[model samples]
Target: MTPDLIILADTIHTMDDPPLAGPEDSQHVQAVAISGGVIAAVGTRQDAGQWQEADTQVVDLGSATLTPGLVDGHIHPVFGLDLTIGADLSSASSLDEVLALLQAEGRHDDGWLRGWGLNPNAFGTVPLHRSVLDRVTGDQPAFIRLFDGHSALANSRALELAGIHGRLEFDQASEVVCDADGVPTGLLLEAAAMELVQRHIPQESFAQRKARLGELLRDFARSGLTGGHIMDHSEESADLFHALEAEGELPLRLRAAPWCMPGSDEESWKELARSIGTGGRRWSIEAIKLFVDGTVDNGTAWLYEPDVRGESTAPFWPRPEEYSAAVRYFASRGIPTATHAIGDAGVDHVLTALESLRHEVPADVLRRTVHRIEHIETVPDDLVARFQGSGVVASMQPTHCTHYSLADHTDNWSTRLGPERADRAWRCRDLRDAGVTLAIGSDWPIAPFEPLPIMADARLRRRSGKPDQHPIAPSQALTARQALEGYTSHAAKAAGLWDISGSITVGKRADFTAFELDPLTTSPDEFAASSVLGTFVDGQIQFMLERHA
Candidate 1:
């Protein structure tokens, strides 16, 4: 039989082993055959020739290392693109720079001026408030999101428009920062408070959302991503994705988890489960999302003890017992759940819920629908052991540790955790050694979407170059192979799509990320600086270096 395509590379990592554990490890392969968007064969160059025919369209990728397409375990595509339409404050180093950026944005004709990626570290010792933003925005109604997405700074005009008067009650500790006289300060913590101002901002029309998402997916392919586990989704997003799949070829695969809030009733949960539709061929909604707590920044994370600011530690659900009930409800039906749990207390609650549900869930179904705890920023050694055989996957982001935290344990996040818990930041090595499944991702918009730099950070425990950059718990660093697996096999397993994608095995989807250097042998410094030569999704070339020799 004539295969549709043949990809020839110098090396290929199948990710089917324990990552070069012994002298017998051999994951390198030379060629692969694709037929009907599935791998027909994978072996040495000579072995693959038996599956090829005269009409096979062979792609000679000279000296390139071909591996399974990278999978981002967690990301927010539509939301991230929506943020990009406004001023990008990610580069602003100081409060003055932030105001200058906002001032320039205010000059535009748009009714509401919006910006994203604001880092509070730029403020020095000064406290953030709406008054400062009002100086530049005036009556423009500016709302800027912090880099971590857990907090936002809104001008007084924007707050007035949203009608935020007093402190708001929420399942989590969302607060509308108040001054000495109990006046709103225009600083919103967590979604409950941020949404007050955010809801007033006009939403992107369905047409606009579809267009922007299409653009980002194409960019994702060029950056070597074949698929992503979208952390949050809506009915509109589901429809937009299916519409794109129906139109023609999609650049990448999408597996989205719809947002399931705490206050919704059981009937509502059942309705959401019923309304969930299957993706034509490239996308699907198979999981649900919940927030156990907010990020570690801004003192919103649910913790055993209060942060440096003495903020209350609370879960996102008004009644956490209800959260356990919800998990049980979904787990009984074989639906996987992904909870956003950053603090140890948050993770602890989720583990308890999973443990209670385990008794009722069948082992096979439980294994297939492994519930995940997202952004496990801090966990104790004892709690880490609970994940060993608990059928719970830890979905973590390496760049959160590298890009945001200082290795010296003096960064904002570290300072918030204090010395006692700061040392436990992103225990990737600890969890993996404890026999727990570790799935890594970029968390997109929160960090860069590229997998190479993320993998490098996982291995180095620090950013590339700059001798002054210290390693955060260097002992917790992952090996090059383990880091690669996080984005390949382990990620696919976390998403429950291991049967179809993830590795370069026969009978799997023909998705390949070709790089110029062998990732296994390359140093973290060099690998982080390398680029993708080409990307293939389901046997089709979505992106290739056109100018390359």
Candidate 2:
């Protein structure tokens, strides 16, 4: 009767009920027994005694809390790995700091230097041109991405290397901003910026990429994450994931969604679908990703109104027809689609396409296909109701609300859509009230992929700082329990793996996260800094924080 593993704790936050519910109702027992990598029982200490025998390993997590392992519902793991090699300007708060960092790093002559996580807003204004960058970087080509990843700044030499000497061409929806003299500025918004950067960084070798992926996987495990949904993948990425699985090195559970090119032929998509099927013990392909538009920082997020500077609605990639066709094709094949749509207009276009497809496709086809609109940042009131009834999932990142200065955005939002529409930004509470399923994630490489930080933001509705800014509709803030669910059980459901993981019940995978401080009793700031004492996936200890005897 001895259990292979027994975990006992002072508190267990099942996240099974509302936060106000007393501990007894929300959780039970001091111990959880696991056998064959699945929860065998959840009951009192006395009950656990029945499962205990000579060989049983008792793990007494005294004074700590045990909860379901955190699942980062959305992220770009490949991109996360790439950051290790790229210039790390994420912590540079000001333009001067960024240049100083680059100067100290000393860029190579032929190598393309790239840095991510620079927020222009953090410095009060966008760094205007390559002149400042040129002064610091000398002749080396440098590309620095804004924290949001929607926009990027490139030095003159980098632009020249890409053959975009003084000016760059872009689609109607994209922009390559120029100075008053009509010369190309360092900044390029959305698709255009990505195009230039992509042309410069040559593809990394498979061996190098595999090593990077391994490092990232370990990092995720230490953060108490057991699974993640990779939003953007390529053929190379998919193959790498499979190779890792074969080698038993794919640390966390993976749901890879590769980018579906705009205007892809039917045969091509079908072939890609066949190549990437579902359910390996460690990896699966549950969705196809499409980029409908870009982020707000670069002023490229397709908005209902013009940008604050009086620019027209931002561009859409792949065009409406091509995007619609791709969605319909994926729908017909019974595969869910995740579209990156940040602005109101972008969300509207995606919904319109899905709505149109729903009518043409059979009822069964539509029901089987669960469409997701990523980053529903600015939704319309009417669309909120439609989204609720349409079975669309809102895969959102709450941390974005805190990271982007809402005060600056509020002024621009009100000017664009009037105060009435401004209330609809990241409506987590509204969507849940309307009976819509919410899946939360950290768009990593944009923000750190830690669930607690996101949970705190969702519950508090404000960041740790000076108040007086308009919080995103306080009524829309989720309770602590609801916020946890968004990142756990609900996130699993979004990725189509709810039944297999996400909960702490008998017959479920024994994946759990142990925290140094009980979240139930900890302060918001303490929760944000809480450490993961241990993480287990499929009853195997993936990470354990070193403790001194």
Candidate 3:
């Protein structure tokens, strides 16, 4: 039978092999043929040639590798794009540099200035307070987000606009850092606190957001991403994403989760659930997002003991039982829940809650409502054992450790957790060994959006080229194939789309990520430096780096 398209590559990792190196090594298949948006055959080049006909289009991927389309298990597309609108403080090395960046960006016509990706380590021994930000912004309302997305720094004007003066009540571990005099210092920890200033900041229009999202999707495709499981969904996002899907031919697939905060009323929960109707072939909204605790960098992670700074250690949901009830509330309705649980205490709370629901919900219901925990940053052996066959996914980002922390355990995150807990950083290998499903992601605009670098980091656990670059917890590093699975098969399982996507097998959707070199056998440095030659979705080329360039 004739095929619609044929691709010949040096290697093809079908992800269907029995725990082998790659498909080329296991099955000796060098070519794949597609028809009607599904894989028709996967065999040798000769086999593919035999299926060629008058209309068959053949693509020669010289020395390139073809694998299942990459999937970022967790990302924030709309929010990431929104962050790109202002000056990027990600590269600032010191507090003065951060102020210099804000001064360069200056005030906007709205009398507000915005910046994202501020690394807390830049402050060094200095405390992150409004006094520093006020130096540059003066009267302008300046709001900057830390690289971790768990905290923010707002100038005094922005704080006043948010009406935050002294202490406040919050369901989560959110806090407005106050001075010795009980006055806010312009530092907001966690979503609840950050939202105070975030809500007051000028928001982008729906049309502007749509345009930015379109650009972001194109960027995703170029980076070899064909699917992204978005963490949070805004009302504007729901409208724009559905509109994009309706327009047909999305560059990539999106499985979004509408946020479910801690303070919403029960009726509001139902309203939020009803708001997520259904999506088309390229998108879906079938999950809800929640945060159990904040991050360790800002001393918000719910650790069993206090951080080195002796800061408040509390769960995002003040009442543990209330959060447990909320999880079951949504799970009973057949909706999956993804919770952000970073510290060991936070991970324990989530696992205990899921265990409690084991008896209440039926087998099928529980399986359908597979819960996921994002960024299990620090977990003990006992808590890790709880996820074995528990149907909970460990959605992790390896770059978080590589980019944010150092091997010497002196990074802000490590110093906060202290030597003991910090040594447990991202247990990727342990989770996989315990039979827990692992789904990897970039958490973009926070780290990087590219999958290759993230995959390499997961495998190598250290930066490339610099011999002095130490490996942060090398014992936790994942194998190359295991890291690949984090972005392919396991990522699909994380989003509950394994049947239709994930693997490059016959009768499955023809979504593929093409690299200029065989990523499986390539050196970590080379793979990290490699470019994505092409990204195909449903047998159609959505992005070709050369053509676009």
Candidate 4:
């Protein structure tokens, strides 16, 4: 049978179990042939020639290293369209910089001042309040999403517009933080609280967002991502993915998980279950996303002990038992779950919940089910051990540790937890050594979405391209091989898609990422700077580094 497409590179990682063939340093397979969007042949260049016909489209990426396409274990492409609108404050380090950028952005003086990715460190000693931002915007009615995405800081005008006065109640662990005197501080914690002000802001048209998402996915492909596990799915997400796929081939294959929040009951769970597996060619809803707790920075995370601020002592679900039931309910029907559990107690609860299903389900069902804990930010030795021999995949963002916290125990994340817990940082190496499946991701809009830097940061234990910065728990660093596997092999294991994708085995889907240098052999710093030669999804070229008109 003639192959429809042939991809020939100098090196291929394969990332398979015994790796099919090739030494550890280089050369797994020099060429791969695809027929009907699946790998038909994987062998040397000479072998590829035998399978190709005259009409076979061949791409020769000379000197480039090909591997199973990189997939982000967690991302929020749909939700990010709204979060990333207005000013991009991701690079603004200080309050002065944030204000300067916001002032320039909202110079129009009439519209709402919006921003996303505002680092909590920018507040420094000052508390996060409207007064600080009110200084700049006056009455511009600003609503800025913090770097954590769990919280937002709104200006006085914006709060007034939302009719937020003093405090409000929410079924979830959400709070409209107020001062001792019963005045809204403009610090909204968790989703319910933030939506108060967010609803007042102007929204973009569906068509506008659809166009932007298409552009974003192509950018993700150019940055060497052939797939993503989207953690959050909106009501319009399926429509958006369908629209983009109808236009042409989607650059990245996306798997979305819609949230099952606290206020939801069994009926709500049933609704989500019915919506599962509804998608187009390149996208599908295969899993459910739930939150066990909010972030550590906002004092909403479900920590074993309160931070220095006397916060993070509660779970997002007011009734912790219901969270477990939600997991079990979905797991029984054979759907996987990816829950956001950052704090130690949150991690403990999720682990305990997964363990409860052992007797109910058969050993085979238990073995096959893939329930992951997203953002296992900090945990003691015992909890880390629970993941070993247990099917609970640890979905982590290495950049969260590398970019957010400081080694000195002074940053918000570290300062709150104090020295002992702070000493335990990300623990990527700890989990890997324990035989846990660790899938790496950017948790984009919260962190940068580039997979190269995320991979580099996993090994570096500090921000890539900023060697001058000290590593946050240097001992927790993963090896070059472990870091790459987190994005490929382990990521596939996390989503239970290891059989069909993840690696370049024959009969697997023809998804691949080509980089200028071999990811495994290249130095961490140099690898982070790799120019992606191209990204291919299902035997179709998403984009090429160099395009000829």
Candidate 5:
């Protein structure tokens, strides 16, 4: 068959073999021939002329570096649509600034005032309550989501709109956060609590959401992403994905996982199981996402011991044993899972649950299970050691460490866990050193989703832009190659799709990202600032810099 397209780059990091290996080691592979969305040939520059045909589209990324398409092991493009609505508070460093931005948005005449990406650190000594927000958004029903995505602060009007009068019980660890007088403080903790006010907020139109998603995915492609493992999937999410595909080809391929919440039962589990492999052309549901706990920053995370605030001692699931049963149900059937476990107790409970699967499931069935533990914000030495032979993928985000916390234990996440657990931080290098596959991602809307800057943060243990900042945990920093692998090879492993994706070998899918600088050879800082020349999915150019044309 005549090749559909051919791409030539100065260097191609196939990532199929050991470090520094490529398709043509003896002679740099100057050409990659693609036919029917798969790599047909990879050879020297001389072979490019022979592979060319009347219809072949050849793209020469002069002096650029080509590598396996970067995939975010975890992201929430669809859910983020709602979380990123209204004002963006990701840039505000102080509570004063947050209030000013919200006030500036002004009270919508018929709609609720909304904002997202509010950092908890901005609260400082002040408690996270709606009373402060009420000052700026009085009687307007304002709802602002914290940066963690696990909590929110609603103004009194919003709380009343949702009929949140006082403390309420939940199947999960979520709380209404009542004050000393048994009155709701407007601080909603976890998904269950946040949903109370969120459901009342005016949702955007489906057409609006679909358009936004398409634009977002194109931006993702321009940033060199060919695939993203969407961590959350709802019917609305599926609708959005299908609608985008109906209009045109999705810029990036997506593999999504629908959530299995605390109140779900056997029937719900079965329903989630049935969703597997269902999708449009470029998107599919391959796994189930569960949460063992919330986040440390909100004091909702299930830590081994209580945080300084005396919170975080409980698991998200009311019955921890039921969680293990759910895991076993999936594992025995060969279905994979990606669980969000942020605290030590949460991680331990998840690990212990997986460990029990060995005695319950047959060896062959167990061997086929590819379970992952996400966030892993803080874990003790013993829990970190458990992953070496456990076959559990560590799906972590470096920016969660570099962007959210501080070395001085001053950040909300660190201060909550206290010094001892804070010292553990995100042990990316330790997990890798312990023989665990550590997959990196942005957890977008929480952190910037650009792969290069995230990779740089993985190596620096601090943001690339702030060189003077002290590293959170220097020992946890990943090596240059390891950082790249986190987004490439290791990411595929996290999704159990390495055999078909992840690398540039012949016969594999022809998904690739071409960058102006070599990720492996360039310093992390320089690589983070570099530009993408092109990104391709299924052998089609999803995004190519206009300048390249």
Candidate 6:
């Protein structure tokens, strides 16, 4: 009974626990034996005797903490890694700084030039209009996506390209902001802005995109992420993944969910579904993605009340009826729906739609589908009970609290939501108590994709920078063990791969993350700053941090 590989560590955390009234129990194992890319044994050195063989490759990770590889349940990986090449205005503290950065980057002769990460609330004033961007961009089609990715600021050149001078003929949920003189403001909110920007940004070739994606996947391995869920996949992205798999360039496990638009034809969706069959040993395509609303930063998150500034109740999906139809259609066809809902109104609409679908459809079909509400921020207290045993998963990001903490106007979120609703923000513990399965992720480009920051925030209930700025109810904060499980087993279960890749059981895949510090005992600050020592997928070392001895 010789194993192919054996990894010995100082500590190991296997996330196995039912919902507890308190913290989960952590188990320590001295070694793990792997055979045929699967865990053969998890025990002390003596227990490993049964599986030890002469040819077994033993990797002694002297003092590292070993656990199941982290799974990022939601991320825009393709765009995240490309930010370094574009106009990175994420750290621009003021309008002048943003303009200066753009000017320094120089102008492109091509009609389209893009930048991202500009928050109007961070400046404490209304963003400048197209005229301001035009002054600096000088007729180049410039589109700056807000940090939340729900809105964009477009220059006059971009607007002209989109044929929207000032007033835009948009559908129900999209808006074109205009100044008093009927001129297009550079700021385009929600779907309208996205539509305008989409018209100008030229699409990349499949080869180029795949190369960039492969680079990013390797980067993930270096960060100790052995597997992740692609939140938004297009046909081009799927093709890139398959090509990598065929070429043996895919180093990490991939679970992709193709984007499903609100009004997509049923036949078209079914065809797309048929195209994505069951995944192999390293990749999967078992989910569908939908968006119910935009982000709260750009005033597009379909809020129940007006934003604190009294702007407006944010827009929902363009065609609510059509969106619901799409959800029903996906569910009827056996594809689980993972809908993005950031605002209270968006959450309410999705819940109502799901209930309606359940009433109309057969109970067995409804029960089998893995309907998820992504980013359920600002949830109402009364609705907490509805999630229990309802078969809906909550995929939430913990780093948003840190990002939004820097916002200027917390008054609206604080007042409209009040202290009660604010306490429920990313309510992991409450949802767990209510019998809801929880999964964790970093929205990637929205925040750093590192799992340490997420784990720290989840456990400490606040960013490591400030002590007094805890966003949610501290009681709702998850224990370190629960948070880790949310990123691993719970995430795998959400993606319907629990039996194969979540834990270090005998039959599961040998995917593990080696951390420099013991996540369970490390201080929140240290954990947030700790580095990944290495990552292994299917018993193969994909990334090993070079030790500077």
| Stronger candidate by TM-score (1 vs 3) | 1
TM-score for each of the candidates: 0.96, 0.90, 0.95, 0.97, 0.97, 0.90
Estimate candidate 5's alpha-carbon lDDT, on a 0 to 1 scale. 0.89
- Candidate models: Cα lDDT each: 0.83, 0.75, 0.85, 0.89, 0.89, 0.75
Better of 2 and 4 by TM-score: 4
The alpha-carbon deviation from the true structure for residue 136 of candidate 1, after best TM-score superposition, in angstroms, is 1.1
340-368: candidate 2 lDDT, tens digit per residue: 98878888888888888767788987775
Worst 10 contiguous positions by lDDT, candidate 3 = 17-26
Q: Write the per-residue lDDT of candidate 4 for residues 1-549, one digit (tens) a residue.
A: 678999999988888864554333235478999999999988888888788899999999878889989999999999988789879888888888998999888743338888888999987888999998899988688989998999999999999899999888899999999999999999999899999888877788789899999999988998999999999887788788888888887888899999999978999999999878888888899899999999889999889999999999999999999999998898888888999999999999999999988867667766777999999889999999888988789999999998889988888999999899989888899999998889999998789999999999998998989989999989889998788898898889998989998888889999899999888889899999978889888899887898453
Specify the poorest-scoring 10-residue window by lDDT in model 6.
18-27
Cα RMSD to the true fold for all candidates: 2.0, 3.2, 2.2, 1.7, 1.5, 3.2
RMSD of 6: 3.2
Tens digits of per-residue lDDT for model 5 on 74-103?
A: 899998998898789988888899889998
- Pitting candidate 2 against candidate 3, the one with the higher lDDT is 3
* Backbone atom clashes (below 3 Å) for every candidate: 0, 1, 1, 0, 0, 1
In Å, residue 90's CA in model 5 sits off its true spot by 1.0
Q: Tell me which of candidates 3 and 5 scores higher on lDDT.
A: 5
- The RMSD (Cα, Å) of candidate 3 is 2.2
Colliding residue pairs in candidate 4: none
Error of 5 at 469 (Å): 1.0
For 1-549, candidate 6 gives per-residue lDDT tens digits of 579999988887766444222322234476888888888878876666666778989888878889888888888876554443468887787778888888887765454667777656445554557777887888678887777766677888888788787677655456788888988786877654567667566766778778888887888788778888877765556566678888784678877787776446888788768856655557767788888887666566777876665643654656687778888877887778899987777888888888787777787887667789999877777667777766788899887765564322253244445455465667778887787888998887877778888888888777765577744557778877778888888988887677787876768889999999988888877888888999989899988888776
TM-score of 1: 0.96
TM-score: which is higher, 5 or 6?
5
Candidate 4 scores a C-alpha RMSD against the true structure in Å of 1.7
lDDT string for model 3 (461-540, tens) is 87654457989889998988898999999998887777888998889999999998777788877888989999888898
